[model samples]
Target: MNRTDDISNLFSRFGASADSYLEFGSQFDYKEKPLALVPATPAPEPVVDIAKPVIKHCDTPLAEAATDRVPASSPVHASQSTAPLRHLLAEVARARQAEAQARNEEALRQALPHGRPAKTRAHVIALISAKGGVGKSTLASALATALRLEGGQTLAIDLDPQNALQHHLGAEPDVAGMGNASLNGENWKPLLLAGSAGSLLLPYGAMSEDERRTLERYLDNDRYWLAGQLANMGLGENDVVILDTPPGRTAYLDQALMVADQVLVVATADAACFVTLDQTERLLSERVAMGQAPLCSYVINQFDSARQFCRDMHEVFKRRLGSSLIGVVALDHAIGEALAYGQNPLLEAMSSPACQDMLLLSDTLKTQLKSMDVAESYAS
Candidate 1:
């Protein structure tokens, strides 16, 4: 029996009609049915034509030809291009304005007079250090040399008992300095030694323990003793007197502060230096509060930027000092070499990095003096 005859027999046995199965199978046409359902692929996106037409020069009216060739969107494109040009023009205008401001500032600086008034006394600078062996004397000498080189009469007074400042100024090691003059009741002006490049040097001179004690007593007895002596020297308004004080707290430091118009504290970029500076600041705060202390700033000498520890300390100092940290002298062998040879580093190594730092310091001092003069003039 075939499968169709068996299906018809099964349907007859079940009491269902065979015509119903035939009708269900006939609903779907087998030959005409789709083999598989396939979706149509989407059409490709249309490309935008950004290429602009190039217009050539014509003998006829160019405006008429440009209107014909230009597209409707060209106006928007032109506006977009003009935005960058407008920004460039604005930048150029700002640059020109900045240049004009700078020129005006320079002109004002030039118009200001140089040096203090004749009625005003000489500007006094005191160089102090918290610790010994920090190159304070060398800096004092260099600064005086720099000022003298700028055509200002500069006098360097070595208050340190070591009398080592003269050595840096190319003076004889055994020469008697101001300390000797004070002991013998001789005028200090006669003891003033002419230094290299028209600078003046007054050494501390060799002193015995008793003589040193006597000088300290004199400074203690009179607060303005040093100031009086300086005045007797008859310094001109354009003259600058630099006092190199001994390291740490001393009567000499007090005398220097008594006569100084400005104080420059010298320190190195080290933990010990910072600790000493903290102590010094405490000592100075009382004087500053009383208005007895001179205007003070800091100088970081022998600064080595390559050392990470030094750089960290420098940042700390910057935070502590802010604008009062006025100068930094990079560590350079040239400075040591010049000192060893008993030569002024500012002149001996004029092209060295250390010399450049000295020049910057000198310039800062000059500007400060000028500002003070201007302020005084206004006050008067």
Candidate 2:
């Protein structure tokens, strides 16, 4: 047998019902001669006379004698009354088979348009505060909630060892709470907020003395590393990553700043905080000049226009931060209440006037980040 036959035999052994006729080409009989097919049961004698050579005819001849088997009108055979039903059933079956074949063939060539590119170039945004108790976690949670509900995929990463965003949001640090979550390539549970938008939080996972030390050893370079780790967390297009950092000048903060594509310092509108912003910018600028940092800005938190301190602080911040200052996140009662009640004011308190301000801030931030991404893509 040729290779074609061998392949057919192999397929046949595998119960594939191989069509061997394809190898040699198909055969067809065009003559309209009636061939008497005997029943599956063995006949007592030969039905066709062997002496009569097999005749190939274009038309069938009718039997002449009464003794001869002459077919009656409408072909009154053994299966008589079932004639019309059999013909109808056969036609329906043939049409159905043809339809199925056509559908399968059409499916093979179907493909839709490609997806939209990422709206933001660097997915990570690390939120920092000059000092504690100024609502760093609050703003982080609120921004996360706002961005997610605005049809952006968002993941809030709590980098604070204190875990304030955890308690404020009434969510046990999901990564830690589960105890099973790990960076060691284990199954992790996402802290999904009880809301409509696709927002999530990855609490600093439960770490032992050993894990903490290991994490700390890697902390010096965790800024860019955190971005890589987050991408590995199965995020998608238009996704915004919000990092809630520890309140200090710790190396953790540095890592966050360096990794951040956009850094928003959530500071209160006060002299002390504004001075801290100067120190922060100076630090970032030094590192940026050394080619060790990324782009960033300041988002002055709790700015009340009615208060003189807040109004004056804004001016000082703009002057101190200069063009690096993207926008200010004004003080909002809804934001405080949302944090007090462990909720994201942006999504829930959207109708609140205070929440509207936060929304504006979120929009401005998103716009800035998207523009940065577009510029990067263009440069590339």
Candidate 3:
């Protein structure tokens, strides 16, 4: 028998259907079409047929395949579906940012005295002069002591490279100070020395010529260097900080002006100071924008009432400066005496005219600061 006939007889003996048996040399035809590889470019808008199943590579990860699937019959496009979610997320991020800012401001207000805001905290008074030997450092130190005695937290900072403010404050001259600490990458808080009447003194410290030049270069490059330093000192809102700068235009003076809440220009009743007023005013005008200058005033230091020339110059200053002339410090022997003895004249010689004038001047300054704070509070 033929092999196909023998296979059919075997299938019939096993009870198989006739259609199930095939001839050995006959071919079987498949009705389904073969799968082709994915084309390089797909149709812009391809319709999907769910009834037909497409075979893909077995190496494709299940997670990737699931993520890539998007039904063609979906009402919303992918971009359109995600747009509202992205906008909502952005709005939530902004709300969190605003909340964080509000918390910081509230914490600042709590840390300050008398509920003062951050803008008015730590009142900075910078003492400057048009020429050397104008008692700028002396006035700065004395003012700090006077303010401290008047029940205000006070700090005196010497920005002058001369480093003479510490001596006036009865601090040791050769001790390490701000410049030394800055050069050595040390904290300035440890350098703060005790001063007369419980005030704090920050000396410029001892520095070599090259070191001084380096510091000047730093100040010149960073306009906000001094300001940033002061902010990091953790001063109370009502605390007073007095900056003693070198006379005339300097990088130190520029930095002091950048942070000073009040500018106290020291001038002796003389031709040098008088002649330099225009130049000093011009420098100040250039440093700060118009209508935003700090509260600036003049104090005539070493005014000798006994001399007609001094009296005439004092009158000229009054005429020239008008209400900007804040006070006059008489040329009292007590001031020089206090310096020689390393004592504060306001504390040592309360009966002296200079002491009385300083007390009055400090009170006047306190009043001005109070007024400023009130105005700012109202404006805010």
Candidate 4:
């Protein structure tokens, strides 16, 4: 049994297309056969016989004889005997048929309508870091909630293996890891995170060797199709899709970075985080030009200004990152408190300082997403 067999069984069992198809490969059972194939014998090749060309002279008279002929009374035989004119007529007919087909296809496409995709409001935003535990996931999840609350459908993808985002979002991840679920199967769907607003979430589960290879292709474009496969589910209804990536540089990270509507580089206010920022800058440069990233925001987590060292570090970063610095998050215990309870800070305690900062950050992010909608319209 192989992929084709499974496809046939699926088509036989249910007419609907499989909920998801692998961009790489599939599996199937061959026990059931829709029809038997009949083998045929190969045909023999044909041989051509040699022939000599027969050149014939026009039956019209010599030049001296027809030299005085009048236009209206010209002999019909001369006109009928013109082989070159007949060949020209065949060429004209072919060109007309080709032109007609092209016109019909264009008209047919124009007649077709496009629906708002389920993932329409879902935009893919990737948060990158140079190393582990830099608070990238925390910022990514926070931004997602902000965007959704601002009135856009959203899906926050946690592509990291630890699933650290679970702690921040306050829910046990639906996916325990690849060991618990196998995406090589159609039943394997991304775990959706529930929220009060316009967003929904799909958590990244662990992958087996084969599952990882299969999923790798979709990490970019046509090679891997999670984006398209999910889009096919009508998930595009939301305007933006958001993604949170694992630490350091990898092809998969690059893939997400390539498709991201925006990329937020997270770092602490320390010199080490600065090194990571430099590397991140280079990575982004290869994928997006200055200001072309749509929205490039820098978020320094656990920021504190009371401490002389921390305040000095903030000043240093402000000068370095400049306009790229979207906002700074103060070190607040309320964020951790909200996470322990599984609620967005916005919903947990609106009066908290962290929540206040988040509110402002959300407003700025909402504005960016709105502008994106307008930009998409103009591009179309």
Best by TM-score: 3
Clashes of each: 0, 0, 0, 32
Error of 2 at 171 (Å): 3.3
**Can you tell me which runs of candidate 1 are displaced by over 4 Å?**
1-120, 148-152
Q: Provide the clash count, candidate 2.
A: 0
Give the residue spans of candidate 3 off by over 4 A: 1-120, 149-152, 290-292
lDDT per residue as tens, model 1, 133-167: 78898889887787742345888999998888888
Looking at candidate 3, what is the lDDT of residue 140? 89
Q: How well is each residue in 9-91 modelled by candidate 3, as lDDT tens digits?
A: 87789888567754466488868877877856866986678897766556778897786685667587587766687789999
Lowest summed lDDT across 10 adjacent residues in model 1 is found at: 111-120
Q: Residue 43 lDDT in model 4?
A: 97
Worst 10 residues of 3 by lDDT: 111-120
TM-score of 2: 0.58
Highest lDDT against the true fold, candidate: 3
Q: What is the TM-score of each predicted model, taking all chains together?
A: 0.66, 0.58, 0.66, 0.59
Full-model lDDT for every candidate: 0.80, 0.65, 0.81, 0.64
